[model samples]
Target chain A: AQSVTQPDIHITVSEGASLELRCNYSYGATPYLFWYVQSPGQGLQLLLKYFSGDTLVQGIKGFEAEFKRSQSSFNLRKPSVHWSDAAEYFCASKGNTDKLIFGTGTRLQVFP
Target chain B: EPEVTQTPSHQVTQMGQEVILRCVPISNHLYFYWYRQILGQKVEFLVSFYNNEISEKSEIFDDQFSVERPDGSNFTLKIRSTKLEDSAMYFCASSANSGSYNEQFFGPGTRLTVL
Candidate 1:
C-alpha cells in the first residue's frame, strides 16, 4: 500500500516570511504527488501536482514544490506568504490504482 | 469556473441510522471518487467509479458502504448503518478521465455528525 508522511503537524510563520512544508511518500513505483490547501469551512484546493517530466512544478498563490526522487520527498515552498495563506496543507500520493493516499495535514498559522 | 459540489454542508444523525451524502461532479467528468477525513487524520479514499461501475475501492469501503451514480450528474454515498466512528467530513471528487492529464477536482466536504 502507498502511504504519505508529513513530519510537521503544525507550523507558524509571520506574514511575508518564507514557508516550507515537507512531504514524503512510500510507493513501489513512481507516484503522482500533489499538495492541497484547505481553509476553515472550505474545500481542499489543489496547490500543485507532479506526474512526470519536470522535477519542479509551480502552483497558484506563488507556491512551488520540488520533486526529489532520491529523497522520496515533494516539499512545498513559497518565498513569501500572506496572512490568507494560513490553512491546513495536505500532501498526497496517487498509486497505480489511482487512489490518492493523503498524509496527516500540516496546520499553518500565519501571524501578521 | 467549473467545480464539484456537495449538498447539506452538515448533517446530524443518530447512530444506526442510514444516511446518504450527495455530490454533483463537474459536468463531463468521467471518474468520480469518495473520500473521508476523520478529525485530525488524513483523507482516505473510499471508492472510485467510472463507466457506470466501480473501478477501485479501499478496504475501508466495506459492505456497510455503497456508492452509486444514479444519474449523469449526481453521485451518492450511502451508509447502511452509521457509527460514531462514521462522524467525519466526507468529500467528493471528480476527474475528467483516468488519464494523468486531468487531476481530481474536490468539492467542499459534507460534515456528518453521528450522535
Candidate 2:
C-alpha cells in the first residue's frame, strides 16, 4: 500500500525564521507529491506539488518544496516565516490511483 | 477564481439519522472527490466521481454511503444511517482532469458532528 508520512507531529519556530517540514512517501513508481496547509477551521489549501523534471517546485504564498527520489521525500520549506504561517501542514502523494494519500500532518507554531 | 463549494458548513446530527452533504464543483471540472479527516487523523479519501458515476471508492465508504450528481452543478454524498464514528470534516474537491499530475482544488469543508 502507498503511504505518506510526516515524522514531526508539532514544530515551533520563531517568527522570521526559516522553516522546513519533513515528509516521506512509499510508492511503487514515481509518485506525484503535494503539500497542503490547513488553518484552524479552514479547508486544506494546496501549497505546492512535484510531478516531473523539476526537483524544486514553487507554490503560492512563498512556499517551495523539493522532491527527492532517492529518499522518497518531498519536503516543504519557507524562508522568513510569518506569524500567520502557523498552521497544520500535510504531505500527500498519488500513485497508480486518483485518490490522494495524506500524511498525519505537522502542526506548526510560529512564536514572536 | 474558480473553487469548489460545499454547503452546510457545519452540521449536527443524531446517531442513525440520515445526513446529506452537498457540493458544487468548479464549473468546467470533470472530476469530483470526497475526503474526510478525523479530529487528529490524516485525511482519507472516500470516493471519486466522473462522468456522473463513481470511478473509485475507499474501504471506508461502505454500503451505507452513496454519492450522486443529481444535476449539472450539484454533487451530493448521503449516509443512510449516520454513526458517531462518522463525525469528521468532509471536503469536496474537483480537478479539471483525472491524471495524477492534475491539482485538485478543495472546498471549505463541512464539519459533521454526530452525537
Candidate that scores best on TM-score: 2
Q: What is residue A83's positional error in candidate 2, in angstroms?
A: 0.6
* Tens-place lDDT digits, model 1, residues A1-112: 6889999999999999999999999999889999999999999999999999999999999999999999999999999999999999999988676688899999999999
TM of each candidate vs. truth: 0.98, 0.98
Error of 1 at B64 (Å): 1.1
Best-matching candidate per DockQ: 2
Fnat of all models, as shown: 0.71, 0.83
Model 2 residue B36 CA deviation (Å) reads 0.4
Over the stretch A28-53, how does candidate 2's per-residue lDDT look in tens digits?
99999999999998988999888899
- Could you tell me which 10 consecutive residues in candidate 2 chain B have the lowest summed lDDT? B96-105
Worst 10 residues of 1 chain A by lDDT: A92-101
How well is each residue in B1-115 modelled by candidate 1, as lDDT tens digits? 9999998899899999999999999998899999999988889999999988999998999999999999888999999999999999999999987856658999999999999
Off by over 4 Å in 1: none
